[model samples]
Target: MPNYIALDWEQDQLFGIEADVNSGAVRLKRAFNLKWPDDVGTDPSARGQWLGTQLQEHRISASQALVTLPREDAVVRHLELPPCPADELSELVRFQAAIKSTRPIDELLLDYLPVEIADDEVAQSVLMTTVAREQSDSIRQTLESAGLTLASIGLTPVAAAELVVRVEEQQRLDETETSLVVWAHGDRVEISVIKRRSLLFTHSTRLTSTEDTSQHIQTILAEVSRSFVALQKLLPDVSIARGWIIAPNEEAETLAARLQERLSISTVSIPEISVRTIDPLNLSGSATVPIDVPGSHAPYVGPAGILMWASGGRAEFVDFLNPRRPAEVKDTRKLRAIVIAASVAVIIGGGLFWRQSEVAALEKAYLDAKSEQSSLEELQERAAGNVENVTAVQEWVDNRVDWLAKSHDLFNDMNGTERYYLTDLRMTLAGGSGAGNITGNGESKTYGEVITLYQDLGEHPERVVNTHEIPRGKDAEYPFRFELDINLQKPEPIEEPARDDAEDTKTETEEE
Candidate 1:
C-alpha cells in the first residue's frame, strides 16, 4: 500500500499524479496539471514556491518523488556486450558512456538497464542513459527549495515502456511472443520491441499536420520495419509475431489494417489511457482530473505509468539521476567488511594452531607414562623370582639336624660306665630325632652286682631305658649278658609282653 508521486515536465506546464502502483492495482488519489506563469522562469525562487503551493493545495502526499526529465535533456545509447564478469561489465559501460555521451564522462550522470533477451543468448544489450550534471542541477535545486527530495529521474520512453509491460501483465497476455508496442503521445509515436514481457528496443517518431496522413502512416510503418530488421540482426533467434498500437480505437484499427496489408502482421488496438482503476486510493475524492483531455473519466495513463515505474515495476529502466547512490559510503562499507573478515580468519588460524600444539604435548606425555609402566612391571617380575630363591634356602637350613653335637653327647654319656662294654653300638637319625642301642657282657663279684649295674645305667638322665639282663649258665665265670637302648629325649612308656604260665609258677614258688 505504498504510494509515489510521478511528475511529468513539459515546456510550459507540469502534470502529476499520486497513486499506489503495487499489485497492478493503481489507485489514483489525485491528478493535477499546473500552468507556469510567463515570468515564473525568470525568478528561480518564484518557481519553487509555486510548485510547493500547488502540491499543498492538491494535498498530494508522497514520501518518494520520481521525475521524468524532458527527453531533450538526456542522451540515450543502445549498447551490446558479450558475456563478461560484473566488474568488467561496469568498467566497459563507463568506457562506452564516455564515447557515446556528448558531455564528458565526469560531467554526465550515467546509468543503464539490461535489455532483456533470450535465456540462451551469449551476448546481452543495455539501454544506457546519461544526463549532463548542469541539466539536472536546476531540477534538483528547485525540488530542494520546494522541500522535496528527488528519488529517481528518468526519460519518458522508459516510463511508457513500464506502462506497456504492466498492462500486458495485468491482462495475462501471451508472455513468450515478441510484441511491438506503437505508443502514440501528442504528435509522436514511440515504437518499442518487447519479448517475454521485457523491452528490447524503443524509437521515437513525430508527425506534423502538413504531412499527408497516408505518408505519415507509411513513415511510422517504415520505422517499425527498420526496427524489426535491426532486432533480427541483433538477436537472430527472435521474431516479431504480433503488435499492439497504443492509441484511440479508430486510429489503432486503421493503423492495424495498414500494417497487416503492408507487413502481413496482425495488430490489436491497445489504447494509451486506461479508465479501469486497478485499485482505488484511500483519498477522499477524485476532485481534480486531467483538464481538456478528451475522456474526463480516464486518468492520464502516462503519469500513472511513471508512478508504477517508481513503485518497483518489473520493466527495466535507468535512473540516471539516482540521489541514493553515494560513492563514498559504498566504498567505506566494502572496505570495512573485508577488514573484519580478514581479522576473523587470522584468529581462527591461531586458535587451531594452539589446539594442535596442546594435543601433541598430551600425546607425548601419554607415551612416556606407558614406557615407564612397562619398565616397572619388568622390575617387579625379577624381584619376585629373587624372593622365591631366598625362601627355599632358608627352609633348607632350618630343617638340617646337628648330627655331630648329638654323637658327642652320646659318647659323653657312655664315659661314666666301665663295668659295661659295648660289644656293638648302633645310632640312627630320622626327621631331626635320634636313638641309640648298646649291647655288652658285664662281670661283677655276683649276679646282684651285675643287676645293680644295670639299674644304675638305666637311671642316668640322658642314657639307657628298658634294660634286659640274661645269664648264660656256666658260660664263663662272668656269666651275665645285658642289652640296653637309650633315647635322646624322654621316651613314651613301653607296653610289656605277657609272661608264660611256667614262668609265672616259677616266680610264685620263689616268692613263697
Candidate 2:
C-alpha cells in the first residue's frame, strides 16, 4: 500500500503526519508540528515552492495527503432533508445546504453524511459540512508544490470525532449510544458527537487557556456541558455515554479527573498512542519521523484521524475536492430562447445587408445623374422663348362640350314621338367643365307617351335626365304636361378600325 501524509494547519502553524496506510492499518512514520516558515507568500506558486523545499529537506516523501480546513474556517450543521430516494438524497442535501448556508453555495465546498435515513417517508438527519473554496485552494496549491496528490479534505471537528472513534478500537456503537469528543489546542476547542463511527454534531469554541488553572478548567467544563445541551436539541433521543479528550498524559488525566468530579460524566483522556503497550505504529522501517519525539500529542490528533480514515477507519468525512451540488436538470427555457434569438438575428442581418445594397445602388445612380445634369445657364436660355400662352385656342377647344351631338340625340328621340313633341327647349355649357345641361317643357296628347320619351332620353349611358311635373294643359289636344332637365357630358369620338387596302380597292373597282 502507498504511504500518505495527513496534514492540518492554522494561520501560523503547519502539521503533517506521514503514515504507511494498508487495509485496516495506519502506521505513523513521522509527525511534524511546527510554526509556519517565514515569508512563504500568499500566491500558490511561491507557497508551493516553499512547501516542496520543506518536504524535501525533511525526507518525508509520501506523495498522497489528506488535509484539513481549520476549525474556524469550516462549518458543520445538522440538517433535516425531505424524504427522498437514495439516488436523489445527495442532490437534495446539496440543495438544502445552499439554502441554509449563510455564504453563497458557489463560494463554499459542501459535503454531507447521512446520520439517520428514515424508512417511513420521514425527514432524514444529515451532518452537512462546508469550507470556503479559497481556503481549500490554498491547501491544494501548497500540497501540489510538494508533489503530493490530495486524497480528501477533513474539517477539524470532524477529523477529531473520527480520531476518537478509531482510538476506541471496539465494536461500533449503535444509533442510541453517542460519545462526546473534545480536542483543545491553544485557545480553540472542538466538541463533537460521534455515533456509529460517524459524526452527528460538531462545534468550535474558543477558550482563554487550559494551563492548569481552576478557572480555565471550569470554563472548559462549562463549554462541554453546553455542547451536550445543544446536542439534546439537535438529537433529542441521543445521549453521550462516554467522553474522550486528546492531551498529554498528565494533562489528559487531570482534565478527565476534573470532568468526572464537576460534571459527573465518566470521561477518559487519551494521552498518546503509547509506544510500549498500544503500538499501532510500524517503527520497523528506516523512517524520517523521530521515534523519540516529546511534547503534547494534541496537534497530531486531527491529522492522525485523517490518516486513519485513509487507512479504512471509515466514517463521515468531508472531501472538498468532490463537493456536492444541486441536481442536474436540463435548461430547456434557455435553450429555446437562444434558438429564437439566433433566428431573429439572422433575419435582421439579412435585412440590414439588403438595405445597404439598395443604398449603395441609389448613391451610384445619384452620382451618374449629377454628372449628366444640364448647365443652369443653358436651361434658363431654353426657357426664354418657350413661355406658354395663358389662354391658348386649344385650351378653350379641348374643354368645349359638344352641344350639337347632345341635341342630335334628343331630336332623334323626339322625332319618333309625334304625340310627345317639345313645346320649349334650351341648352347651356358650364365653362371649362366639358359638360352641359338641357331644360325643356313639353305637352303630350297621351298621358303615358310623355314618360316613354323621357325614359328613352335617359337611356343614354353618358347623360343624366330628370323630369318635373307640370299641370295638365286644358287644351283637349295635349292633356299631359312634363318638364325635363338633362345634364350632358362630352361625346366620345369614334375610332374606326382600318379597312384592308386591297379590300377597299376591290370594292371601288367592282362598283366602277
Candidate 3:
C-alpha cells in the first residue's frame, strides 16, 4: 500500500491521482482547492471544506496521506562532504547543516543520500531541506482533521524534481546528462538544471514581464543559461542533453524557439499538461482547455514528483528538500538484566532440591547401618554368657582342645613323666566352672585318673591340673602335690608326595 494523497494548492486547487501504472497501484490519491481573490495570503483552511468534500466524493482518505508545502516555504541547498563512514555521515551532515542554516537545528529536519562512491571513500553531495516547525504542525493538524495520516511532508521543488526524474526515466533518457526543465506556471517560471535525473540547480523567478513573449523567452533563456553554467562548474564536462518546456502550447513553442536559438540544444514540449485525468467534482464547469499550463498543468509536475518520491523512486536531490527525523529506539540492556536474573533464580531453586535429595538418602543409609551394628553387638554379648550357641561354643572348645593336645603330647614325650600326676582337677568353661573327683586301680589308676581328669575337664587343659595343693594328713603321711609343666617343640617338616612314582605309573599305563 504505497499509495498516498498529495495536495498542492496555493491559489486555485488542482488535484489528480498519480498511480504506478506497472502495478496498477495508486501512488497518490489527492484533492485540492484553489484560493480565491478573497483568500489570498490566507491559511489553507479557507478551502479546507471544499477540498474535504472533493476528497469524500473521490473516496480519498486525508488521514493516510502526505501534504506538500508551497515552494516558497522551504529552503533547499546542496552540500558536499568528504568521503567517510556511513554511520558517521549523518552526524556530520547534521553538524554542517546546523552551522549553515539560519534557523536553529531543532526547528529543522535533516535528511541526506549518497551521490557517489569514489576510491575507498564516499564523496557525497547532501540535500539540505527544511520547513518551519509551526507550519508543519499546522499542516499536520489540518490533515488529521480530515482523517489523514501525514506520512511525509515536503516542498514543491523537491516534488517537481521527482516528477522530472520519473519522466526522464520513463522516456529512457540518460540521467547523467544535463537537461533543462522549464516549468512555467501562472505567474512563476521554475527553471531547473537536472543532471541524470538529479536536480543540479533550481531558480524560480516571476514571469511578470511575459507581456512581450520574445523578451520573456530571452529572460528565461538567460536564467537557464546561468543555471547551466553554474551546474557545469560543479559537475565538470557535462552538457544539456535536451530541454523540456512545460507550458501552454504557445508558451512552450516560444520557450523552445528561444532555447534553440540561445543554447543550441533540442527542445521538447509536453502538451499533456495535466499529468493525470481531472476529477469532475472539484473542477469548475467553465470550459477551459485541458492542456493549458495555468489551468491544471502547473501543479501536476510538483505533485506528481512528490507522488513518485513517496512511491520509492530515486530522487537523491529531493532528500535535501525533505529531511527525515530520527526515530526513537528501545533500550535492550534492561531487558538483558531481567532475563539474567530470572535464569539465576531457576538455577538456585534446582540446586536446593538436589541437595535435599542427597541428604535424605544419606540419612536412610545411616539408620540401616546403625540397626545392623546394634543387632551384631547384642549377639556377641549373648554368646559370651552361654556356650549353647554353636559358633561361640566351637570357638571355646577349639581353644581348649588345642591346649590339651599340646600338653598331652608334651607329657608323653617327656623324660620323667612318672613324677607328674594330677592332684586336684577343676574345669571352667567360658562362663561356669566344674570340679571333679576320680578313683582307679594301681596300674590302671594312674591312666584312669588322667582319663577321668581329661573327661571331666571338658577338653580344658588348664583345669586338668591342680589349682591349690597340700598334704592332706600333714607330715606323718608326708603328703606331696605334683604339677606338670610342658613346653612344645618345633615339629619336623613333612616330606612332599613323590611325583616320579606317579609319572612312572602313568607311563606304564600308557604302554599297556
Candidate 4:
C-alpha cells in the first residue's frame, strides 16, 4: 500500500504520522518538543541542527511528507474564477491571487481546483487559493534536508475541512447545504463552510479570552454571512440548505448553540474524528473532543486532514500541483538542437581554414619558381656580352699603367740631371686620381727649377699631385719635407640585362 506522511509544527513541538491509504489506517511514529536555545532562530545552523537531533530522537522515517503553514503568517482566501478552459485556469488563478494577496504573485504559491462546473459549456467556475512562497519553501527545505519528499503544503483549515468532509461522506450525509465548522484550539479558531463536499469558505481568527468569545462568534457569523452573500451573487439561482459545526470538545457546541440561539440557525456537534496519533500519552486529558471543535486536539487536526486527503478522500481545492507551467521536455529538445547546429558550424569553418592554407602555400611556390627562371635568363644574357666588356676594361687599365710609368720615368730622368734636388717625396692615389709632393734643397738656385717641375706634373690631372712644404731656411741644405695625399674618383658600376630582354635575345640566337 502507498504510504503518505503528515507533519505539523507547534511553537514548541513537532507532530507527525504515516498512513496506509488503501486501508484508511494511520500510524503516528514520532512526536516531540525540542528545547532549542533562544538563539536558534538567529543562528543559521541552529534550526537544522536541532531538527536533525529531533528526527534522530524520534526515529522519524524519510518518505513522502506534507506540512501545514502556521496560521499567523498565512492568509487563506477561498476565491471563485470565471468559467474558462482548464488549460487557462492557472493564469486566471494567478491573476486572482495577485489581486487578493498583499504579497506579489512571484512571492506566492498558488493552487486551484474546480468546485462545480456550470451547465453552460462556454463558461465554468473554479475555486482558487494561495499561500506565501516563503512558507511553502521553508517547509519543503526542512523536510527535503531530512531526506523526505514534500508531497504538498496547505493551510490547517484546508486539511481539517478535508477530514470533516471525509467523515461526512462516510456517514452519507448530503452536503448540498451551507454548513459552518468551527474548531477552537486555545487562543486560535479555525472555521470553514463546506457545500456539497467542497469548501466554499474558510477563515481563522484569534480568540484571546472567554469574555470576548461572543464578539469573536459574532465576527465569524458576519464572515459566514458575507461568504453566503457572495456565493448567491455568483450563483443567484442556487440555494443554501443548512449549516453544521465541528469541534473536538463541547466548547464548539456551546459556542454554536449560543450562535444558533442568537442567529436562529440549525447547528449540531459531531463525534471526534479518529486520526493517526503520535503519542497516546499526549492524547490523554481534554484533547479528545468532537472532530468539528478544537480544544487541545487542534494540533492533530492538520496532520489528520492531510492523511485523509492522501487516503483517497477528494480534495475540495488544489494545494500545490499546477499542470500549466511551461514544459521542460520541449525546452530540452530545443537546447539540444542549438548545440548540434553550433558544433557543425565550427567543424565546417575549421575545414575551410585548412583548405585555404594549403592553397596559399601552393601559390607561393609557383611565384618563387617564376622568379628563379627570370634570374637564370638574365645571367645567360650577361654571359653573352662578357667578351666585349672585358676587352674594354683591360684596354683602359693598360693606358693608365703606361701613363703612370712614363711619369715616374720623367721624374727619375730629371733627378739624374740634377736640375733640381728633391729632399722629401710623398704620393697617394684615390678614386682614380692622385697627387705627389717634393721638398726643394736649401739652394736659392734650385728653387726656380723645383717650381717648374711641380707645374709640369700638376698639368696632368691623372698623375699630378697637389704639393705643399715648409718655407725654405737660410744655410739649410734641405728646407722642408713635404706630405701630401691624392683624391681619386670612383669608376661607374656595370649594368646587368633585364630578365625579359635576356630571355628574348637567347630565343633569337637559338632560332638563327
Task: State which candidate has the highest TM-score.
Answer: 3
Candidate 1 structure quality by residue, lDDT tens digits, 440-484? 334433567556665655666645466565655453654556554
For candidate 1, which ten residues in a row score worst on lDDT?
A: 274-283
- Residue by residue across 419-447, what tens digits does model 4's lDDT show? 44445443333233322232223232355
Q: After superposition, how far is residue 238 of candidate 1 from its true place, in Å?
A: 7.9
The alpha-carbon lDDT assigned to residue 272 of candidate 2 equals 23
Greater TM-score among 3 and 4 belongs to 3
Query: lDDT at 225 for candidate 2?
Result: 79
For residues 282-372, write the lDDT of model 2, one tens digit per residue.
1122122446445666777668767766767556677778654446668799889999999999989989989999999999998877766
TM-score of each: 0.56, 0.56, 0.58, 0.50
Please tell me which model should have the higher lDDT, number 2 or number 4.
2
Rate residue 394 of model 3 by lDDT.
81
Error of 3 at 445 (Å): 18
Say which prediction, candidate 3 or candidate 4, comes out ahead on lDDT.
4
**Poorest 10 consecutive residues of model 3 by lDDT?**
279-288
Who is ahead in lDDT, 1 or 4? 1
Q: How many residue pairs clash in each candidate?
A: 0, 0, 16, 16
**Which regions in candidate 3 have their CA more than 4 angstroms from the true location?**
1-3, 11-24, 27-33, 37-61, 81-98, 102-124, 137-150, 167-180, 194-198, 209-219, 233-298, 317-322, 325-332, 335-389, 392-512
Candidate 3 is scored at a TM of 0.58
Cα misplacement distance, residue 208 of candidate 3 (Å): 2.4
Q: Which regions of candidate 4 deviate over 4 angstroms?
A: 2-4, 10-13, 23-37, 42-45, 70-72, 76-80, 98-102, 117-123, 209-244, 248-250, 259-295, 321-512
- Candidate 4 global lDDT: 0.55
For model 3, what is the C-alpha lDDT against the true structure? 0.54
